[model samples]
Target: MSLLETLAGKGLRREPPTRDEALALLATSDDDLLDVVAAAGRVRRHWFGRRVKLNYLVNLKSGLCPEDCTYCSQRLGSKADILTYTWLKPGEAADAAAAGMAAGAKRVCLVASGRGPTDRDVRRVADTIAAIKERGDVEICACLGLLRDGQGERLRDAGAHAYNHNLNTSEAQYGDICTTHDFGDRADTVRRSRDAGLSPCSGLIAGMGETDGDLVDVAFALRELDVDSVPVNFLIPFEGTPLAGQWALTPQRCLRILAMVRFVCPDVEVRLSGGREIHLRSLQPLALHIVNSIFLGDYLTSEGQAGQADLDMIADAGFEVEGADVPTLPEHRREAAPARDAAPLADAVPVPDAAPVSGARADLVAVRRRGAGTELPPNA
Candidate 1:
């Protein structure tokens, strides 16, 4: 068997590749790329098998971020125009969860923008989490900026099954993306979430101008941190962000990154996060050969492949979405009827606490002109 196959068979942690070895794999030929993915698929099938976990993300608070993350559309210093809003009330959050469940999502993620969650923010999120859980059958994940003391525990008590705080990039490359926070701080949050009995979901962004060495470092870091879930994001450049024009990803490169993550973190729930449609495009089903999970519905501040299209892609690829039997609301919860609005930028607002997100959060707003360049059909 080849080195890649051996690694996949033995499991990720058992014979993890060295940096040099990982580089060699990155330089692999296109003909071998599918083989690499197939090998990783064997490992994935061994653990998960055609079981694709679909997650839905609700941007509880739209823009209003305090940090200056270079890759985000909602960072403090961004010039890209994006929406601005505060935290939604508990009822509104719950309603979104119900919609997600109806849409066949196994979990609903509550994401807010800011440097970190304050005491009030945590309490409110916890309450909303409780309400969502009470509605039944869906897992809850929180992606607030950072975790404060005891906040992870409170989230768990309130029925949060997982907490997502992505490291975004390698330690060396992290400072280049966001100076407001350190890589260590992100690691600490993941550790605290794990300690608090919440499954930690973390991952990195590929095509962020990082080196192959940087990617290897991130994979190793995720393994070292014992993260339960890893999200591999491709950088989707926005016109007003610092890295606005930096779109260096092709489908092959994206597939390689997913395969690499699977090789390094075999048992973890490797997810295909943002930029999949833009970067992977028609090859999205191939991504499932490596990643066992995906973000369904929508992403924060960006458009994703349509839900039905994603389902079609998965079926076409010979895989099935997990938890298709889960019940969900027929229509998504919305604050108001859909209307035309300019897309919101990353640095638009400086973290405002809106209102309880439960029943009062407005209907899901569609950012006009945001989906223009991507391959996804309009209105998806």
Candidate 2:
């Protein structure tokens, strides 16, 4: 069988891909990109069908972060010219979340920037979660940096359904991206959230000047974590952050990364997270075939396409916006957690980066100018 066939068959059975198989998929040529997407699409459709789950970001707090993770525009000591603000009042946050739910967001991701939340911070966010839950049937996912021992349980008790702390890159290449916390710190948080009965939602960022092996390593690690969702983010390379001018991904490469994530963790909600508008560009529609979830409207530090445009694209691409009542995962996955075995990354094989994307439009790396912190209407 072809490599695609081998991996897709395994994915259909909810089997994890070997690290070498994942590396080979990443190494597939631009000429075979469509075939690779087609193969991954088979697995996507099997578990998710034609449904696209929409999640919205509510930047409960913005900027002024203590950690110096290089890719972020919000990190300390940076001059990204992005919006900076403290916690939004619970009513203000609920109002912001209501704007997105009106536009068909099934979940509202409540995000705050910091090393971790204090007990006071947790209570504040829990209050916001209660306020949002009062509004309707929306799911609340908290991304409040790392968690203390009881914060996950506290959020879970407050009607939060999931917790997001992305394993942003591979364990091997993690220090290259951020050093305030190590890979173990991230993995431990995911485990704590899972133990707290909050669905684990973690993922990775591509185009951070990582090698192909580094990308493969990220996918396998997420599988081992057995997360309920995998958000594949393309690096936005904000001009003021350390990754400024790092426009290394083509639309084809973005699709390959999504496909690889799908093959590695087939049953999870593989989301086309931040930077889809910039990196995927005209190819965004094709990505829908590989991913079942996406953020609606604006991201935390940047803006996505208009909400109506996102809806129109889903219709144009022959898919439906997955309903709020619909569960994102397969019945088996939602019924019970499965055991996950780690797949070790092969250190001997290092694949070079793809050639630089010519005419990578720097204009697409826009700073968020409105919504949460501004008087303007939220994008959704």
Candidate 3:
């Protein structure tokens, strides 16, 4: 049998490929790589077809993190000039969800920084989620740091459908990136969220100086955990962050990583998360072949491709955005577009009763939530 067929046949049950084997695939010529990617694309098509799931992030809080995670601009003792603020009022978060819905996003993520949420934080987020749900349709995914024992239940009750706590990297390489907490802590949160009945959305960051073995380990770990959604982020080096100016990743390398993850975890929602523009750039269109979803609009502490541009890209690639198949603006808000340069940065204080405060960093810090209601940090 052909190598591609053999690889596809083994599927997720296939033994993890060795570093040399992965490198051999990575080293394939562009023509050969495309052929491999084409095979992988079939797997993607079989499950997701031409429909693209677009997610928008609402950084409900920004900056003021206590953890010393090396890669974050919001970590303690860092000098990155980002905005910081507290949680948004419930009304505002809901309005943001409406904006996301108007922008054609299938899901709107509510992300916060710091060490989980206190009971108070949970209630506040829960209320916001309830309000968002009242409006209808858009899926709500909450990222409130490390989840507490019952906080996931509270969120589920509040109408949150998913929880996002990225593993960031493989277990073996996690320590090198952040010393404040162990990889197990992140895993536990996912488990807790699952037990609470919320869909567990977890993922990793590539190009953080990890080995192919490390990548394989992370891919298998996600598969073992049965993650409902996997967001594969490429590290976007920020000034004052530990990994700032570390390494540059090529588009082909990024595609290979995406293809590898798709081959390993065939059924999961392999999303193209942060760093798609800078690393993938012109090649972003091709990534959709292997990845079933992507983040629409902006990301935490970073600008992303404009919503209209994303719509154009989807059409150009022969794929359809979830809500708008023909590429035209929605009927109700044809003239209304998300402000081109209006990404908001707000400080995210932990909701009380979330997770224990590890010496590292709080789950989230200074980040931005697009839509309505802007909560600026003390200095901002």
The weakest ten consecutive residues by lDDT in model 3 span 371-380
> How do the residues 199-305 of candidate 2 rate in per-residue lDDT, one tens digit apiece?
89999999888998989888888888889999999887776788777778889889999999999999999999988987788899999999999998778877777
Query: lDDT: which candidate is best?
Result: 2
Q: Sorted on TM-score, highest at the top, how do the candidates line up?
A: 2, 1, 3
Q: lDDT values of the candidates? A: 0.75, 0.82, 0.72
For model 2, what is the C-alpha lDDT against the true structure?
Answer: 0.82
What lDDT is obtained when candidate 1 is compared to the true structure?
0.75
Error of 1 at 51 (Å): 0.6
Which segments of model 2 are wrong by more than 4 Å?
A: 337-367, 370-380
- Candidate 3 RMSD to the correct structure: 11.7
The CA lDDT at 136 in model 2 is: 72
* Per-residue alpha-carbon lDDT of candidate 1 for residues 1-380, written as tens digits (9 for 90 to 100): 37676667666334576667677777788888878888888878766778787787877887668899988888887777666777788887777776556555677898998988898898899888777766665667899978989888877777677799998888988889888989999999999888887778899998789998899899999989988789999988876778777778888988988888888877778899998988787788889888888987567876677666666677778887665342211122112112212121111111112212222113465321252233332221
